[model samples]
Target chain A: MNTGASSTRRRHSGRIVTALLFIAPWALGFLLLVLYPFAASLYWSFCEYDLLSPPRFVGGANYRRLAHELLNGEGFGRAVWNTAYYAVASVVLSVLAGVGLAVMLSWKVRGQAIYRAIFFLPSVVPTVAAAVLWMWLLDPGGGLVNHWLTAVGLPAPNWFKGVQEALWPPDWWSGRAAFGSKDALVLMSVWGVGNFMIIYLAALGDIPKSLYEAAALDGAGNLRRFWHITLPNLSPVIFFNIVMGVIQAVQAFTQVYLVSEGRGAPAESTLMLSLHIFLAAFQNLEMGYASAIAWMLFVVLLAATAALFHSSRYWVHYQGGSP
Target chain B: MIHDKATFRAHLLLLSAAVLFAAPLVWMLVSAVKPAGQLTQDPYSFWPREWRWQNFADAAAAMPFFRYMRNSLLLAGGTVVGSLFSCTLAAYGFARLRWPGRDLVFGLLIATMLLPWHVTMIPRFLLIKELGLYNSLAALIAPTFLGDAFSIFLLRQFFRTIPEELSEAARLDGLTEWGVCWRIVAPLSKPALLTVGLFQFIAAWNDFSGPMLYLSDPKKFPLAYGLEQFVSSYSDQTHLLLAAAVMFTLPILVLFFIAQKSFMKGVSTTGLKA
Candidate 1:
C-alpha cells in the first residue's frame, strides 16, 4: 500500500515537470507579449508621452483631457454617439439576421449545402478586399447602384461623400432611405454574419426534432413554436453572441479604417473608438493618450460584459443548470 | 395540406434569403470580369456590358501572384503543422496531466483569450524586430507558429472527451507517455485534428494584420496583404482591385470546395463545444 502511494506521488511529480516543459513557450510568450504590454499600457495611460519621447507621468492628465477637454470640443461627442450607435445597432441587427438565416436554413430543403456554401463565401474574402469591393459598389458618381437608381426613375444620393445627406436623406422621393450614412457600416457588418450564422446553425441542430413534433401536435404555429421552444433553447447562444459581438464591435477598426480612406471622413461619421485609439497612437503618435483610451475602452468592455452576464440570468436558459 | 404549404413557404423563404446573402459575392465576381471603365461607370450592375477575362491576367501580371501564393501556402502550412504539434502537446498536458496549480495554469490560459491582439500589437512587433525575423515569411508565420490560447483550449476540451483507457493500454505496451500520445491518441483524434487544421489554415490564409505589420518586402507578402497594396494604389481601378481580390480569395474558395463536408462538420462540432 505504501509503495502504491509512493508510485502515485512519483507519477504526479513526473507529470508536473513534463507539464511545465510543455507550457514553457506559451508562458514565456504570455510574459513578453501579453502581461508586459498589459501592465505597460496601464502605466503609460497616466503619462503624456509621444512615441519619440521618454514617458513622463502626468497623473490622470490624459484621462482628464479625454473627458473634459476633448469632450467639450468638436466631433468628440459626435464620435462617441456615432460609434455607440453603430456598435449597438450592428450587434442587434447581425444577431437577428444570423438567427433568421440559421432558422431558414434548418428546414428540410433542396441544396442546403449549396446555400450554406454561398452564404459562407463572402466571409472568406479578406476584410481589406471586401472594403475595396464595397467602396466601388457605393461610389456616388457613375457607380452601378447610382446608375441603377437613376435608370429606374430615382435620384442617386452621394454616399460616403455627403455627410448629412448620407445619414438622413431629405424626404423627397422615398420616405425611407435604404442605405448610406453610418448605416453603411452596419450593412457592411451584417455582410460578415457568416460566422454567427454557423454558430446559430449548430445551436439550431441541437434542438430535438421531437420537440418540434410535440409542439406541432399541441397546435403551436410556426411562429409560436419558434418563440416557445426555439427561442428559449437558443437564448444561451444569443447571449454569448451578443457579448462577443458587442466587444468586437466596440473594438471595430479595420473595416472603418480601410473603407473611409484612413480619414474617417465625410464628417468623421465612421471613426470608431478603436480607430480613434489607432489614430491617436500611430498617426498622431500620442502613445500615452492612446493608452488611456485603450484602458477606458477595456474597462467599458469589461463592464458591458459583466452587465450582459448579470442580465442573462433573467433571459438565457440552459438545459442542465445555470452555472 | 397546411404542413405541405408550410414546408413550401419555408423553402421559398430560404431560397430568397440565400440568394440575397450570395448577391454580394456574385457582384464581386461579376465586377472582376467587367472592364475597368465599365466598373467605375456601372459599379452595382448585375451584368457587365463587356467581359474582360484578361483583367484577371492583367492583375496577376501586375502583382507577383505566384510568389505571394507560395508565401501564403508556406506560412499557412507551417502555422498548421507547428500549431497542431505545440497546441496538442500543451492541451494533452492540460487535459491528462495531474499536477499542482494545474487549474490555476489552465485559468491563466483561458484568460489569455480575452487579452485583445490590438493591445499587444506594438509590443509583439518590437519582439519580432528584436528576433530579427522581420521582412520574411518567418514574420508572418513565426508568431502564430508557437501556439494560440484559443486553439489550445479547443484541443484540450477535445482531448478531455477522449477515453483514458486507450492511453493506459498503450502504456501497458511499454510505450512512453509521448509514445502513447503519438501512437494511440493522435490516430484516434482525427476529427479534432481536422478541426484545428481547418481553422488554422483559414486564419493563416486570411491573415492580413501580421503580414501588414511585419513584412516590408512585397514579394514576401501574403495574398491578403498583397491585395491591400493594390487597394492603396488602385482604389479607383475597381475592376483590377476586384480581380486581385478574387485571386486572393480563390484559394480559400477552392479549399472550402474540396473540404466542404469535413470543414462544416468540424466547425459545427466545435461550435457546440464552444
Candidate 2:
C-alpha cells in the first residue's frame, strides 16, 4: 500500500513537470509579448518619450492632454463617439444580418453548401485586397453603382468624397443628393459580414432538431420557433460573436487605413481610434501618446467585455448555468 | 410530391441568396478585365466589353508576385507545421495529463482570447524586435509558432472526445505517455489536425498586418501585403488595381474552395457550435 501511494505521487509529480514543460513556451511568450508590454505601456502612458530619448515620467500630463485639451477643443470626443457609433452599429447590423442569413440557410434547403461557400468567400478575401476592391466599388462619382443609379434616373452620391449625408439614401434621393460621411466604410464592412454569418450558421446547426420539432408539434410557426427555441439556444454564440465583433471593430485599422490612404481623412470622418493610435505611434513618432491611446483602448475593450459579461447572465443560456 | 415542391422552393430561395452573396465576387472578377472608362461608366455591368488579360500580367510584373507567393506559402506552411506540433502537444497535456493547475493554465489560455490584440500588438512588435527576428520571415513565422490559444483549446476539445480507453490501452502495452500520444492519439486526430492546418493556412495567408509590421523590403512581402503596393502606388489605373486584387485573392479563394466543406464541418463540430 505504501509503495503504491509513493508511486502514485511520483507519477503525479512527473505529469505536473510535463504539463509545465508543455505550457512553458506559451507562458514565456505571453509574459514577454502580452503581460510585460501591457505593464510597460501603462508606464509609458505617463511618460513623455519618443524612440530617440529616454522616457520622462510626467504624472497625469498625458492623461490630461488626452482628456481635457484634446477631447474638449479638437473634437476628440467626436472621434470617440464615431468609434462607439461604428462599433455598436456594425455589431448590431452584422449580428442581425448574420443570424437572419444563418436561419434562412439552416432550413432544409438545396445547394446549402454552395450558399455557405458563396457567403463565406468574402471572409477569406485578404483585408488589403478587399479594401482595394471596395474603393473602386464605392467610388463617389462615375463608379459602377452610380452608373447604374443614373442610368435608372437615380442620383449618385460621391461615396468617398462626400460627408454629412445619410448612410443609406432615402427614396427621394435625386441628382442633387450628396455623399454620406464616411458611410462607404460602413457599406464595405457589411460585405464582410460573412465571418459572423459562418459562426451563426454553426450555432444554428447546433440548435438540435428535436427542439424545433417539438416547437412545430406544439403549433409554433417558423418565427415563433426562431424566437423561443432558436434565439434562446443561440444566445451564448450570439454573446461570443458580439464580444468578438466589438473587439475587431475597435481594432478597425487596415480597412480605414488603406481606404483613407492612411490619412484618416475625408474630413477625418473615417479616423477610427485604431488608426489614430497608429498614426500617433508610427507616423507622428509620438510613441508615448500612442501608448496612452493604446491603454485607453485597452480600458474601453475591458469595459465593453465586462458589460457584455455582466449582461450575459441575463441572456446567455448555458446548458447548466454558472459552471 | 408536395414535399418535393417545398424542397424545390427552398432550393430556389437558397440559390437566389447565394447569387446575391456571390455578386461582389463576380463583380470583382468582371471588373478586373473592364476597361478603365467602362469601370467608371458602368460599374455594375457584368460583361466587360474589353478583356484585359495583360492586366493580370501587368499586376504580376508590378511587384515580385512570385517572391510574395513564396514568402506567403513559406509563412503559412511553417505556421501549419508549428501550430500542429505545439498545439497538439499542449492540447495533449490539457486533455489527458493529470496535474495540479492544469485547468487553471487552460483557463489562462482561454482568457487570453478575450484580451484585445491591440493590447498585445505593440508589445508583440517590440518583443519581435528585441528577439532580433525583425525584418526576417522568422518574425512572421515565430510568433505564429508560439501557438494560438484558440487553436489549442479547439484541439483540446476534439482530443477530449476520444475515449480514454485508447490511451489506457497504449499504456498497458508499455507505451510511454509521449509515445501513447504520438502513436495512438495523433492518428485518431486526423480530422482536427487537418482543420487546424486549414485554419492556420487561411489565417496566415490573409494576414497583412504581421508581414506589414515586420518585413520592410517589398520583395519580402507576402501576397496579401504585396498587393497593397497597387493602392499606395502613384498610379490611377483602376484596371491594374482590380487585377492585382484578383491575383492576391485567387489562391485563398481556391484554398477555400478545396477545404471549405471540411473546414465548415470542423467548425460545426467545435466551439462555433457552442
Candidate 3:
C-alpha cells in the first residue's frame, strides 16, 4: 500500500513536470511579450519619454493634451473621427455586403467553386499590392475608374488628393461631389470583404434547410424566407465580424501609411489612429504621448466590445441557447 | 425545378458581382502588359494595345525583385517553423495534461488576441532593439518562436478533439510525455499544424508593417516593403508598377489554389468556433 501511494505521487509529479516543460515556451512568451509590455505601456502613458532620455513623470499632462485635442477637433480629434468613420463605415458595409454575397454564393448553382475562388482571391491579395492597385484604379486624372466616369460624362473626384467625406460631407465640403482618401480606403476594404463572406457562407450552411422549407410551405417568398430564416441565423456571425472588423480597422496601418505618404498627407485626411500612434512614437520619438494614445485606444476598445456584447443579447441568436 | 426567371436573375447578379470583385485583379493583369508610354497616352483601351510582356522583365530589373522574394520566403519559412514548434508543444500541454492554473493561463492567452498590437507595439520594438535583434529577420521571427496565442488556440482545439485514449495508450507503451507529443500527437495533428503554419506564412508574407518596422536596410526589405519603394518614386511608370504588383500577388494566389482547403478550414473553423 505504501509503495503504491508513493508511486502515485511520483506519477503525479511527473505529470506536473511534463506539463510545465510543455508550457514553458508560451509562458515565456506571455510574460515577455504580452504581460511585461502591457504593464510598461500603461506606466509610460503618464510619463514623458522621448526614447533618447529617461522617462520623466508628467502626471496626466499627456492625458490633458489628449483631452484638449479631443475637445478642439485638432490632432487627436481628427484621428478619432478618421478611425470612427473608417471603422464604422467599413465594418457595417462589409457585413451587409458580405451577407448579400454569401447568400448569393450559397445559391444552388453551377460554378460555385469558381465563384468562391474569384471572391476569396481578393482578400488574400497582398495588402501592398492591393493598395497599389486601388491607388492606380482610383487615380484622379488618368486611372480606370475616373476614365470610365469621364467617358460617361460624370464627375470624378480627386480620390487620394480630395479631402471630402462621401456620406457626411463636412461643412467645408461646400456642395461639391468628392470622394476622399478615407472614402477610397473604405471602398477598398469592402472590395476585400470576401473573407468575411466566406465565414458567413459557412454559417449559412449550418442553418437547417428545413427552416427554409417550412417558410416556403407557409407561402413565404424568397425574400421573405431570406429575411426571416437566413438573416436571424446569420446574426451571430455578423456580430462577430463587426467586433473583429472594428478591431482590424482600428489597427489598420499599412494601407493608410502607404496611401497618405507615411504622414497622413493629402492634408492628414487619412490620419488613422494607428498611423497617428506610429508617427507620434517612431517619427517624433514622443514615446510617452504615443503610449497615452495607445492606452486611450485600448479603453475605447474595451468599452466598445462591452457595449457590443451587451447589445448582442437582443439580436445575436445562438442555435442551442442564449449566449 | 427552380424558377427559370429567378435563376437567370440570380446568375446575372452573381456574375456582375464577380466581375466587380475581380475588377482590380483583371485590371492589374491588363495594365501590366500595356505598352509603357501608352498608359500615359490618348486612348484608354481595356486590353493592352501591345502585349509588352517585357514590362514584367523590366519591373524585375527595376528593383531587386528576386532578392525581395527570397527574403519573404525566408521570413515566412522561419515563422512557420517557430510557430509550429512552440505552439504544438503549448497546445499539447494545455490539451492533454492536468496542471494547476492551466485554465487561467489559457484564458490569458485568448485575451492576448484582443489586445490591440498598438498597445504593445512600442515596447515590443524596444525589446527587440535591446535584444540587439533590430533590423534583422530574427527580430520578426524570434518572437513567433516564443509562441502565438491564435495558433496555440487552434492547435489546442484540435488536440482536445484528439482522443485521450491515444495519448494514454502511448504512455503505457513506454513513451514519455514529450515522446507522446512528438511521436504520436504531433503526427495526428498534421492538418491542424499545416493550417497554423499556413496562417503564419500568409501573415508574414503579406505583412507590410513588420518588414517596414524591423527591417530598414534595403538589402533586407521583403517584396511587400521593397515593392512600395516603387510606389513613391516610380509610380509614373504604371505598367512596371502594375506588373510588379501582379507578380507579387501571383505566388500567393497560386499558393491559395494549392492549399485552398487548409486556408478555408482555418478561416471557417476559427470564425465559427469563436
| Top TM-score hit | 3
Q: Candidate 2 has which clashing residue pairs, if any?
A: A140-A158, A140-A159, A144-B43
- Order candidates by DockQ, high to low: 3, 2, 1
Worst 10 residues of 3 chain B by lDDT: B265-274
Q: Find the number of clashing residue pairs for candidate 3.
A: 0
Q: Write the per-residue lDDT of candidate 2 for residues A25-134, one digit (tens) a residue.
A: 67766677777887888888888877778789988787877797355745345457667767876788788878877887888755677677777677778788888877
Candidate maximizing DockQ: 3
Give lDDT tens digits, candidate 1, residues A1-323: 99999999898788778888777667766777788888888888888778677899999988887787356744345556667787887899888998998888888867887878877666556676677766776677766567777889876866666554333334546645545557777777788787778888889989888999999999998799999999999999999888878877887777777777776887777766767777777778787888887877777778888999999999999987887
- Identify the CAPRI category of the predicted complex in candidate 3: medium
After superposition, candidate 2 runs with Cα above 4 Å error: A1-7, A73-78, A152-154, A165-182, A208-220, A317-323, B1-16, B35-44, B266-274
What stretches of model 1 exceed 4 Å from their correct place? A1-9, A73-79, A147-157, A162-181, B1-4, B37-51, B269-274
CAPRI-wise, candidate 1 is medium
Model 3: per-residue lDDT, tens digit, B1-274? 5588778888998899999988889878888998987788843678777899999999999999999999999999999999999999999999999988899988988899989999999999999899999999999899988999889999999999888899899989999888999999999999999889888888889899988889889999889899998778796788889899999999888889999988888888785211
Docking class of 2: medium
Best by lDDT: 3
Give the per-residue lDDT digits (tens) of candidate 3, residues A140-235. Answer: 977889988888887788888788788664543564657888889999999988778889999999999899888888999888988888988999
Worst 10 residues of 1 chain A by lDDT: A163-172
